[model samples]
Structures are given as structure tokens and as C-alpha cells.
Target: MATMEWIAACREELYALREELHRCPELSHQEYRTSALIEKQLRAWGIPVLDFHLETGVVAKISGGHSGKLLVLREDIDALPIQENTGLPFSSQVSGVCHACGHDIHTTALLGAARLLSEHRDQLHGDVLLVFQCAEESFDGAASMLAHGIFSAQTPNAVVGFHCAPQLQVGKVEISAGIREASCDSLTLTVVGKGGHGAHPDECIDPVVMSAGLLMQLQTLVSRRNKATDPVVLTFGEIHGGSAPNVIPDQVLLRGTLRTFDNRVRMAHLAALEDLCTGFCRALGGTCTVTVEKSLPPLINSPDICQQLLTSAQTVLGEDCLGSESAPSMGSDDFSCMLEACGNHGAQYLVGTGLENDPATRMGLHVAENIFPSQAIEPAAATLVQFALDYLN
Candidate 1:
């Protein structure tokens, strides 16, 4: 079939898959229905589904007619906790749950690629592993799958995954090498102090005052302590203290995230945060406890894998679809855990998707309330399929 005709024939199926997933969005380890849907489809396509040691994920292997190196393609199958506001016909039906991050699109693209490749297995040169991972929204899923022996079982020479970008134009692919995303650390700080009556100013230690001071000092770390060239973001996303304005609460809780591209910078930021919190609480005659949870390492793409992706993308979608080297983002991805597990096995990782450059239209990461157009599905699937074919050949 001609390329246009082939894509057009598959378009409805792909969009239907995306819509189905979007309507019934699940979060993290709670993707039982989603996993089953993907598994059933792969089985129907005649692909061999492996026993996913991780309970909430699926891995389907398609070995080519001739023996060669193994290649892996991954798609995260978890949705965010945001409520849907897109108003699309296929918008999330589950209240307070949605695929705002485009995992539905990624999953659909990979499933389409898997079906196409399985049908053309006789023309392939090596084995292919289609990995549908869960709990990418959390820090545990990739590490959980890796620890359960998925990477060792497949032992692929290269692995690739992509995310949808609302900023990029429809039907285009954006590629970036090196540090594509930052390390993420979620921190919760509790400041304990003495409570007092609303009119008694001298009796209370005022933990709220200390918490505000600490928040201000945290921002200065990026501006004064870190190098100008280094990218670091310290955000205090939430704060909770007294219930009523008249009451001087005994404790205040502060929650935020830390993002950085450099390991040294990440460490430095953590150390500074600890010191600042401790010092500020002590000065205010209050006790403070800070907990860092769900931390993920920075995503660094392997050089060889990136080059292979560039070549594959250029061959399939032409040079105009490829993007220049862009700076690393402050976002975090669970794929970093997969890369860490397969790093010893000579695995290379890369990302391809759409990104829009307009700042006004861009929403917050993952938790935003919007729907990116479904036009990216075919192009992404085609690029991945062609890349796998090129690698296997």
C-alpha cells in the first residue's frame, strides 16, 4: 500500500484506541483495564505476549524471520490526576482523572506500530520488544519493572520512547540528545512551633513566619548559588497551616519540587535546602523536619542511540521533521530508571514527539487541563516503525 493510504487506513483504529484509553484513564499501578486492552490487541495481532513480571505492565516480543539484535520500544500507560477540561468528544469520562500528558496517544502509536510490525515480521531482521509500562506518573513503575527482570529477559541493544508535546506542530517529530529532562525530588517540610491565642503575639513562635522565610531562601539557591549556565528550579507548590485566620497554628507544612539537570547541582540544591530549613526554623525557635520523596534521576540520552534515531527520523519523515539540539527541560520521566537498568547492556534511549513553541498555548506539565490534537499518532508510529526496521536491517 502507498504510504498515505497505509496511514489513512490505520488512522481511525489509532484514534479509536486513543479515545478508548482517554475515556477510561487510570493512574499509576491502577492500570489493570488498560494493560488488558493492550494485551488483548497484541494477541489478536499474533504477537507473543511475555509474562510481564511487573503486574501492571505488558511486554510483547516479535522476533523477525532472521536472527539479529533485539530492539525495544516503550510507551507509558498511566494517566495524570487532573480533571478533564478539554471538552473533546473523547475526553476523559472518569471524573478527576485524565490523560493530560498524552500517554493515550503514545500508547496508541506504539500499539499501531506493534500491529504493523507483527504483520511484516517476515521482512524484519531482528526481534522487537513492545513494552507498555505503568506508573510513570509515580517514580516506582520503571524501577519496579527493571527490578523484576524485564530488561535482563529481553536484553535489547536499544530502547526508545516518546512523549507528546502540545507546543510542536501536528505531524512533526522533535528529537533531543544528552540531558533531555531534569532530576525530580519532591520535598515536604514540617515546621513545629508553639501555638498561642490570636491576640497574644509574644506567646507564639509563629511557624508560618519561618516557613515563608524558608520559601524565599529556597528561590535564591537558583539565582545566587548555582552557576548561571546550570538549569535549576526550586518550587514550593503547596503550603498548609492554620485552618482559621484567628488561630496561630502550632505547625505548618510546605510541599514543593526540585528540578536540576546536573548531578552536582542537584546535590548542592538538596544540601542548601536542608541547611536553609534547619537554620530558619532554629532562628524562629521552631523545629523542622524535611522529607524528600519520589526522587528521579536526570534523563540522559545515549549518543549512539540518538544518532540512530536522527538517521531513522530523517529517512522516514525527512530532515524538516527533525529538531535542533534544545536545552534540557525541568520535567522528570520514569524512563530514566529504565535507562539506568539497561545502561550496562549498551542500550541507547531517545524521545520523539510534537512540541509547540507558543508560550501562551502551553499548559503546565502532565497536570494541565487540555487535549493535544491526535494528528501526531501516525507520524510517531511511522518514525518508530521505520527506525526499528532500519536498525534490524
Candidate 2:
């Protein structure tokens, strides 16, 4: 039987697994139950599981009848900390946690590929490494796995992964070469000042004022420092200061992320941010400190490999469903770490999950109410399976 034939045979099972996963979402590094369930399913499919001894996550292997190349198929399995509002029959059972990022779809697609590919082992020319990873929500799962020697024994010839796009219709697939996603730097800036009664405006240093001024300065840094063609985003999502209406807080905390398409610009922006905050605050009788705690590099895809997958995906979704020149996204993914290991031999693309004319299904990812039709799974899985077969054969 062909790959799709095998995939079709297992479609119902895949849907059940997806719902099972959706009903019980787990947070990053806390996917013990998720990992166990994944391991159980892989074992039942007669695939060999590798003992990575990971606290959470699963790694399994499917060897070809003849060996020629090694390809890695990776998926992230962690959920976001968002309350469920879709009210699907299989809403997240966990409180304050849901698979709002479509990781549930990614995981299910990879597992479907695993099952169908295992059935086609005799026809395969290379092995497939199935990586169901955890902690992707924090953008360090791939790095953490690499640190623990996930690729120590042998590096793969190529790695492939996909993220669900809620904005695109379900039958379409998009791939782009070069920089496909932005790099992310988590920024935390603290403005410190002397606290005083609100009534006495002259006595207090007024860090709230300092923080607001510095945020505007940060925006100017992005606009003036970077080229107009190069995109940069500096967002301060959370601002916290002052406890009461009558008293001024000693300090204010501002947390945000810096996303940039260029590496040099990212570095320059970081330096400028520190200088701007320190200089701007001290001049106003306050002090500020900026901390960049975590960073994820831009997702760069291989042109040649992207073309190969474009053809492969066209076989699954008709030729008209393939797109290769779409604008790159600013969202970040940890899969770029794996691409860094394999050089330009890997690519990650977008799999459309949106339904036409359905406002409810068009909500952006990471939103609590974000949802997609189940019909989107077949094309994604079939495309993955076909790509693996084409490359390996």
C-alpha cells in the first residue's frame, strides 16, 4: 500500500488521539502525562522507542528496510497557559492550560506520519527519527534537548517540521526560503525610584513616568536604528507599578519581547535599549536595569529543501494549493536550533488549518478561542509522509 493508503487507514485513530490530547493539555517541561500517552501509542504501533531518559517528551525510531539517509521529523507537544473558551466537546480538561497554539495538530500529524511511514518501511531508503518535544512554549525545548545530547550519536541529513496557520485556508500549504520567522529576546526592564505619598508629587522620583518615557524611546530605537526594509518589533506586554492610589511604588517592572529579522540589528537594539533606559531614567532622578533572559534565533529555511517539500506538498494538496512567496511571520519557534545543527539541510513550513468563511476558526494562534477544522489533518500528514518517501527513496 502507498503512504496515503496507510494514512487513510489510520485517520480515525489519529482524530481520536488528537481529541485525547486536546482534552488534557500540559504545560512546558511538565508534560509527564502527555509523554506517557505518546509512548504508549508508539509502542502499540510496534515502533521502537529510544530511552532518552527525558523527564518529559518522547523519542522513537523507524528504520528503513535499506539504509541510505537519515531524516528527522520533529513536533512540539507542549500547551500554552490559556483558559479554554472554544467550548469544543473535547475542551482542555486542565485549568488555565490549553493547546491554543495548534501543537495538538502538529503532534497528531507527526504521529500519523509515524504510523503510516512505519507501514512503508520496506519501501523506505532511510530512517526516520520521530521527536515529540516539550517546552516549546518557552522557546527552549529544542535547545534543552540538544544540550542533553539528542543528536550526539549521529546528525540527521535533514530535519522537517511544520506549524499550523490559522489564517490560511485548510487546503493550502506555504513554504518560504531564507528567513521565515523572527528571532526573539525576552526583555525585562526595571525602573527604580524612591517611593512617597501620592499627594507629595515633588518628593517621589516617579518611576511610572520614567517607564512610560523609556518605552517610547525603545520604539524610536527600532524605527531609527534599523533599516526600513528590515522588520523589528519591540512590545511591552506587561507593565506593573504602584500598589495603591495614595502611594507610589518604589519600582516599576516592564516585560516585553524584541523580535528582529537581522542578527546585527537585534544585538544593536539590545545595547541601545540598555543605554536608553539607563540614561533616560538617571536623568530623571531614577535608575533602570534591562535583563535579556532568553533568546531564540530566526528560523531560516533551506531553499533547495523548501523546493523539494513544495513539490511533495503539491502532490498532497493540488498544485494550486501550494504557495512559496508568502510574507514571513514574526512568531518564533525553537526548531531553528535543530536547523542550526544540520546547517541548511532542514526547513519548516506552514500548514493551513483555517476554514473558509468561519470567523470562529480564524482567530490568531495562542488565542484562547483559536480553533480549526479536523479536516486539515489529512493533507498535513500526507504531505509529510510523501516528503519523507521522496527524499529517502
Which candidate has the highest TM-score of all? 2
List runs of model 2 lying over 4 Å from the truth. Answer: 198-204, 323-325, 357-359
lDDT of 2 by residue, 208-238 (tens): 8888888888889878877898899999999
Clashing residue pair totals per candidate (backbone < 3 A): 4, 0
Task: In angstroms, give how far residue 14 of model 2 lies from its true place.
Answer: 1.2
Q: What is the C-alpha local distance difference test score of each model?
A: 0.79, 0.88
Cα RMSD, model 1: 3.5
Q: How many backbone clashes does candidate 2 have?
A: 0
Q: Count backbone overlaps in model 1.
A: 4
Cα RMSD of predicted structure 2: 2.3
TM-score of each: 0.86, 0.91
lDDT of each residue in 1-393, candidate 1, tens digit only? 533345567898888888898899999999999999999999988899998566898988998988998888888999888898876888888988898878888899899889888888888899998889989988778878877778776567777878776656655566666788889899999999988887885888888888888888778888998899988988888999998887889999999999998778899889988988888789889988889987788888877776777777777667787654455678788787777666622222233333465342256446455556677787778777877888888
Cα lDDT for residue 225, model 1?
A: 87
